[model samples]
Target: MLKLDDANIEAICGQAAQLPSPSLPEVAVIGRSNVGKSSLLNAVLGKRGLLRVSQEPGRTREVIFIRVGTRGYVVDLPGYGFARVPLSVKHAWGRLVEAYLARRARGVMLLLLDIRREEPSPGDMQMVDWFRHYERRFSVVLTKADQIPRGRWKSASDGIARALGLDKDNPPFIVSVKSKEGIDSIRRLLTQGLMAE
Candidate 1:
């Protein structure tokens, strides 16, 4: 799998209706705010700051699209679990996200989770349920795996899968940007998903 060395970010779509007609297959990166979504993108692409890494949660208001390769597109969706932000702003973003998920063409979605924890909040579960309802192809990937002891990887992944109602046979991968774990697997998965007809 080729690492993202020169992935070029395309346009930032403010509204789902305004999304440019894309020819390539798209893979959406989604997770709670500060779940290392930006960092993970940078790591996968081997480019720092490709996606804006913001300390302030919910800084990414737009849905940014980038070309990963000849046939693949990477979509950085706005983080939805941010708190302490204005309710009006949150509501607007939420509506936009929902519309996109509901209307966009089918594609693969990588839902990120922090490796340190197993259980996610209600909002997280809602996202998973939404994907399931739409019959969308999705996978769970636990980021920051280096933070947890090596022995705990399986247990943590299993717990998360069970909590999310995912089958034990399809558990989330334990990945770490620093350790380079699961990078190859993720790239392969993305490549396959993009190539599938």
Candidate 2:
């Protein structure tokens, strides 16, 4: 089991050039703006108020790299879609994210989706396509699971997976920051990635 108690922010990069050199495996968290990426991360790392959570979307304008234990990192990519920022700024974010992803062949991505949303947005589809195009390792994680009834989880996850062109039987990870559900599973996944040699 990989320990996350020692995890700490390692770097905040606004551009690809500033990204830390790849030394260990990374688990990259990604999602649309206001999808609860920060909250999920905080829960997984067992640290409250570690990653700044903002009511306003698009507050995370840069890629944040966090060192986890002595073996790996957890990367926070800027959220896409539904941000109130200018078009130019969004474009810049897209470019920077693209650059970072293009270079991280060894990294695994956790693509988050709001559990309440019935359909995957255009931005979500684009991200899925990008990951497939590059043959990168990625997993879908449904956030805010506590907002919906527990009985609806199965159906909701299946619906989202179908929308994203993924297997319904193997639905995405259903998570809730409030309930701390599925946080340990995500942590285990990241731990496995880090432990792999």
Return the TM-score for candidate 1, rounded to 2 decimals: 0.91
How high a TM-score does candidate 2 get?
Answer: 0.95
Q: Estimate each model's TM-score.
A: 0.91, 0.95
Top lDDT model: 2
Worst 10 residues of 2 by lDDT: 162-171
Model 1 Cα shift for residue 60 (angstroms): 2.0
Candidate 2 runs further than 4 Å off:
168-170
The per-prediction tally of clashing pairs is 1, 0
lDDT of 2 by residue, 27-92 (tens): 999999999988888888988988999989987888999898888888888999974678988788
- The sequence of per-residue lDDT tens digits that candidate 1 reaches over residues 1-197 is 54457599988888868777656678888888878777887877778868888778876788888887677678888888777888987787877777767765546888998988759777779889888887777889999999989999988888888899887576787788888999878777777766756
